[model samples]
Target: MKNVIFAGVGGQGVILASKILMEVAMNAGYDVKESEVHGMAQRGGSVDCNVRYGEKVYSPLIPREEADFIVSLEMLEVLRKLDYLAPAGKLIVNREKVDPAPVQTGAMKYPSDIEEWVGKNVKNAVFVDTEAILKELGTRKALNIVMLGILSKDLEFTGEQWEAAIRSLVKEKFLDMNLKAFTMGREYKETA
Candidate 1:
């Protein structure tokens, strides 16, 4: 089974991404199980989604060290969840920093070179600008869809399946725009 962990601050759609993946896996006839933790989510706290898929998943929890794929919507949160990633896991980062604490408090302790830091830790890491893509797509809310698209290439899923899942969860009027974001994310290039 492939184990995945989606981590990001609240409002980044990490939970939605996990749910979409779960529905797609179910549609594909895979046995899938998931778990989530959302402490302080309303204050923009961290959110984690543990998802697994295979012929028969026996446990809903992925071991703290066996995540096969880690999708991070925030750069530092990527570091926070790095320990859970398997040795061969792939890390997909949003390449954007969202924490306002440093600037607000004048602490100046944030990592200025996030890509370099990720390279040092993750075996495989891909960084992309999902925020810009969503904005260009005329919707700031589709960042999760954008990230999910990029993840699909590495996971056992595709844009079509994700589209179906989104349609099932959201209002019909917003489906087309979300689909567009998913397509863009799925087509993101992997850096050498």
Candidate 2:
């Protein structure tokens, strides 16, 4: 089974990203299972979605340290979901920091060396400034699509398959921009 965990703050579009992945997996003829936790999402709380796909996926929830991939949309959320990564898991994380309630309230601290920590812990991790890319595109809502494009690199699905998934799920008005964002993300060189 391929287990993927998508983590980020409530508004970061992690849920949507997970949905796109699920659809793509299903389209590829994999038995897919998915679960989501979004308590207090509107208040900027933690949100995550677990997706499993294979010939026969039995569980929606990924066990500890069993995730094949963790696509994180925020810096601190990457830390929160680090333990879910398998020994050889790959991480695609956004290089953006969103302070949690405790940290914003001065009751807790956000780690200063998060990039270093992730580099030290994960065997294969790619960090992207997705926010900056989206901003340049004039639409931050496409961050999820951008992340999806990055993930498409590691999957067997074709660009047409991904575009079909996006076209089916996204609204008509925003389709062009989202498609643009996805292409930009797919072409990203990790150094870009």
Candidate 3:
């Protein structure tokens, strides 16, 4: 894989998601490098992370037009970063929208037609309602894990390897839920 782009609004665990993938890749013995832009970033602003891994990776930066996987934690941001996605890239977007608090509070702004925009721009889009899936799993906070579940399908690691990777990253307490989420995500590819 040349590059992977993880995009979403702030507080959506985009960075954590990338970290998990990075760890998994590294655990699989691949040279991995990741870059993230997160500072005073808030709920409404755009946040993204770049992860590049292979036998040899030179830079942590992922240039526009090189991303092979566009994994979106939020639907709109998928459109926000669409231009950076490679021509034949695959998109995995959470099929729900967490409109920024600004739009909800009438204190900020929001772009229009985000979902439709993404559809028009991306030819290969896989829509997964992460929020709903997590709720089905009996919690709303598991949104990130649920989305990660979808991403598992794209990884080149084995189930055992992925579990080990998750164990290496998550706290012992969050192990069960996270593992469940990851397994669900990893299975998404086989059945998708």
Candidate 4:
């Protein structure tokens, strides 16, 4: 089974990304299961989704240390969900940081050593600059799709399947931009 966790703050399209992955897996004939938690999403609180797909998936919740992939839309979220990653799991993290309420209110500080910690702990970690990619694409709304694009490179799904999933879930008005973002993400190569 392939277990994936999509995590980020509210308004980051965490749910949409998971949905797209679910669509792709379903189209590929894998039985899929998903679970989501939306905590104060409207106020920019944490949001996460669990997606599992394979020949037969019986549960939606991924146990600790069992996820094959942890796709985090924000750097801080990666630290929050790091425990869920399998020993050999790949971590795809956006190089963007969204301050949580505590930090925003000066009640707490966002961890400054996340990158160092991730580097020391994760065997396979990919950091994507979503902000820069979205800027080049001329839109900031397709960050989720862009992250999915990075993830698409390593998954078993075909390019066509991913496009089809995006076409089906994304509205017509935003479809072109999202498609471009996805392509950019798939072709993205980290410079450092």
Candidate 5:
């Protein structure tokens, strides 16, 4: 079974990404279960979705230290969800930083060297500058699809399945942009 934890702040399309993943997996003939947490999400708060797939998935919840992949759209969320990554798991993180309310208000401080920390701790952590990519694509809303594109590299599903899922789930107006984002994400290269 593959346990994937998608993490990000509100408005980052974390849920949408998980849905695409679930849809793609189902299309690929895997039994899938998913769970989501949207703690104060409307106000730029944290959001996460747990997805598990295999021959048979019994639960939507992913236990601590049991996730095969933790795909995070924000750097800080990656740090927060690190414990969910199992041994030899891969951590895919976006290099964008979104300061929380506390940090914005000066009541708390954002940690420095987050990428360094993750790199030093996780053996296979892939970091990408998703926001920059989205900006270049002319749509920040496609960030989630871009992330799904990155995650797709490690999965067994074909590009057609992913594109089909995206086409089915995304609205008609935004389909082209999202498709572009997904393609860009697939072509994205990870740097050391």
Candidate 6:
């Protein structure tokens, strides 16, 4: 079975990214299951999705420490979901920081040592600057797709399959930009 966790704040397209992955897995003939938590998403609160696919999937929720991949669209969300990742799982994280309610309200501080912590704790992690990539792509709305592109590198899906999935899910107006973002993310080389 393949377990993937997609996490981020609201408006980051975390759900859309998971949907694209589900589409890809389903298109490849795998039985896919998914679960989502949209806690205060409209208020920029946390959002996460669990996706599992294989020859047979009986559950939508990924058990603790069993996820093969944790694709986080925000750096802090990586910390929040780190416990779900398998010991040898890969982390594909966008290097963007979105402050939570407490942090925004000055009740708590966002951890400043995320990179250092990840360096010590995560065996395999790829950190991408989705902001820079999106800036170059001329669209800020495709961060999720870019993160998906980075994740596509480790999955078994072909480029064409990914593109097809993106084409199916993304609207026509944003297709070319999102496609470019995916290519850039797939080709991104920086790692942690």
| Model 4 lDDT tens row, 48-138 | 8999999998889999999999999999999889889998999999989888878999999989988888888787897777778887888
**Better structure of 1 and 5 per TM-score:** 5
Mind giving the per-residue lDDT tens digits that candidate 6 earns over 1-192?
Answer: 999999988888888889999999999999999998655655688888999999999989999899999999889999889889998898888888988889989999999989888988788987777777888887778888888888988999999999999999998998899889889988988755
Cα RMSDs, all models: 1.8, 1.6, 2.5, 1.4, 1.3, 1.4
Error of 6 at 70 (Å): 0.5
What is the C-alpha lDDT profile of model 3 across 1-192, one tens digit per residue? 558888887777778788888888888889999988767775468888999999999889888888988888877788777777888888888766777766799896677666676677677777775554575567665667667767776667777776777788888888888888766665554222
- Lowest summed lDDT over 10 consecutive residues: which window, candidate 5? 36-45
- Residues 1-192, candidate 1, lDDT per residue (tens digit)? 899888888888777889988999999999999988766654667788888998999989888679999998888888788888888888988887886566558787777887986777666888887766877799778888888888998876666677788889767887888888888888877673
Which residue pairs overlap in candidate 4's backbone?
A: none
Query: Taking the tens digit of each residue's C-alpha lDDT, what string does model 2 give over 30-141?
Result: 9999998755655678888999999998878999899999988888888878889999899998898888878889999989998887788676998887767887889778
- lDDT measured at residue 96 in model 2 versus the true structure, 0 to 100: 82
What do the candidate models score in CA lDDT, each in turn?
0.83, 0.86, 0.77, 0.89, 0.89, 0.89
TM-scores for all predictions? 0.91, 0.94, 0.87, 0.95, 0.95, 0.95
lDDT of 5 at 107: 100
TM-score pick, better of 3 and 4? 4
When 2 and 3 are scored with lDDT, the better candidate is 2
Clashes of 3: 1
lDDT of 1 at 71: 90
Off by over 4 Å in 4: 39-42
